[model samples]
Target chain A: MTERGLLIVLSGPSGVGKGTVRKAIFESEGTDFEYSISMTTRNMREGEVEGVDYFFRTREEFEELIAAGQMLEYAEYAGNYYGTPLTYVNDTLDQGKDVFLEIEVQGAMKVKEKVADGVFIFLTPPDLTELKSRIVGRGTDELSVIEERMEIAKAEIDMMSHYDYAVVNDKVELAVDRIKEIINSEHLRVARVIHRYIKMIKEL
Target chain B: MTERGLLIVLSGPSGVGKGTVRKAIFESEGTDFEYSISMTTRNMREGEVEGVDYFFRTREEFEELIAAGQMLEYAEYAGNYYGTPLTYVNDTLDQGKDVFLEIEVQGAMKVKEKVADGVFIFLTPPDLTELKSRIVGRGTDELSVIEERMEIAKAEIDMMSHYDYAVVNDKVELAVDRIKEIINSEHLRVARVIHRYIKMIKEL
Candidate 1:
């Protein structure tokens, strides 16, 4: 039996740029991990691919999965359904390939409860002040919207206690390095080693 | 407002080179951290300092600290008293300096109970076979002594689940980087960040 791969949960406030950093990690260290494509009812936004960026699904199908307990964690937001597909994540991890789930703090908490053994890492800007600047710099939102996000950021920070670790997105490369380090460190863990040992003996 | 430093506990089986790695970290990173020198009744082993290396004390004094709850954790191994002093660690952390206690697994566990807020990182060799080779390669020892050490190592691996993280001592640079990442990743934590804010505001 192969030692199972780690299930990584990435969460933070909306404007913390977890998406950009994760994208950078995928583009560069793509071989290190596979991203978990969430199932959602939202329409294809801009350059998103159907099965790549997200597993675009109809409301009826999503509800079916939800009702069947096939959704690890789901929440309806902004008039659309979004959730982690339990089957794909469980299958990928069972195959011994590390997987990533980019999610919100609330959803991350929910997923963590369902998958109690999963690792949760919260990504954040260098500080709250920087987070405010980044949200404003996005330029798509009004000042009031940014202020609203700042409140949400506060709630996000408060919810961070649920996370196992946190990485600051000071620089993409550095953050990615830390993220990779975390994954590597987890592999060296004692439990995993013993699990590998038991299988090694069985094969011997 | 300055963020409070994390209370970190470093532990591993003997001959894992935890002390050597810790010394290298101090040399490279300088003294921004509080190296909690444990108190002991063990005889002065060559160039060891009284307070710097350890707090050399009488057996009676060691018992006194234990009775007073001044010691975080301790053990009597090889007929000598060895333990971590609680006051210095708490004081240094209160002053916003990161504290590192290089301890055995038992002592590390005790610190964990007191400071569950602390980060615990266990250091280990890549594999049990490698650990055997490393122990024998340390010096010319009898095969039985090597076997005894291996048994102890196996026990440590058994208790590895008690640790929060593990760093593989495959290479010096890699181990150092992982340990530093553990420290840095901890700073991004919301509990520590919010505590810093509260403490800073209280000062004003």
Candidate 2:
């Protein structure tokens, strides 16, 4: 039997360019990873693709998924529901495709409780100054909101210890390369091949 | 301060071309790994460098090292003492140069006890048939001895579970590339970078 693909959970502090790195990796050649689409009650923004950006759902529909334990992890953010659908990820992994989940730290923690073997990677900016500049550079948040985000970023960076790997988002391409190397190297982990070898040994 | 270099322990069953791969990696451009020179009481063979191949020593000198805990791991083979000198490995790592220790599975296990965080990699052939052919190709052993070696290879392959990674030495360059990726990716592990980030976070 083929080994199951790695469940890669990519998370980082806000404004750390996690989304940019994820996009580059999926777009790059030789990466066969499936993006785990999240279910969200938020309205689709301009240029957002249905079922690609997110699986848009009504509040009651999301509530039903949560009640049935179908959502791997979910949260109510800004009066809207957002969650990862369990079936999509499980199906993709069952087909031997690596599934990438780009979630916030809190949702990642919840996902960890459900999938203990997931590869948890924390992406970070080179420094807090860079992170702050990126937050300010967004041009969408107010001064007070940016300050709050900086505080949250500090707390999130402290949680890097909980992750299996950390990739600094100094450059988007470099970060993507590091993540790709990490994914390739992890596939060579002896633990992943031990059971297969054991069966082969017994037959021998 | 520069991060301490990764202590890379490479082990595999005999006839798996572990030595060939190690030499190729050191010869490759941009690889700056230091080989951990072993101390041995055996007389130097023709063309072997005194400090490079093995630190040729008298039995008394070798014993002194073992007594003073200077030897990381050691074994007696064919009435001669052979061992890894602890100072060489620790000093190399302290200078931020990766140290490569190529030894048998038993010695690798011993070194793991002393250095709990070392990256242990097990190299193997593509399959048992290939392993058997390689063993026979050596041309020095009798039929019985060859059978004995095949049995040992099976036992050693079972120990792959204890290693952090396994690279099939199907092709020398491919094995080296996988190992390089493992080392590069390991440096990005969160556990390795957490303390540095923690200090930076404190200042921020």
Predictions: Cα RMSD each: 4.6, 2.2
What docking class should model 2 receive?
high
Give the share of true interchain contacts found in each model: 0.30, 0.81
Q: How many clashing pairs per prediction, in order?
A: 0, 0
- DockQ for every model comes to 0.26, 0.80
Off by over 4 Å in 2: B41-50, B56-61, B77-80
Candidate 1, after superposition: displacement of residue B67 in Å?
6.2
* Interface Cα RMSD in Å, per prediction: 4.6, 1.0
Best candidate, lDDT-wise?
2
C-alpha lDDT of candidate 1 relative to the true structure: 0.77
| lDDT, residue A142, model 2 | 79
lDDT of 1 by residue, A102-160 (tens): 87777898898888877788887776567768777877777787777767777777677
Candidate 1, B163: how far from true, in Å? 2.2
The lDDT of model 2 is 0.87
Per-model C-alpha lDDT, please?
A: 0.77, 0.87
lDDT tens per residue, model 2, A86-114: 99899888888899999888788888898
Clashing pairs in 2: none
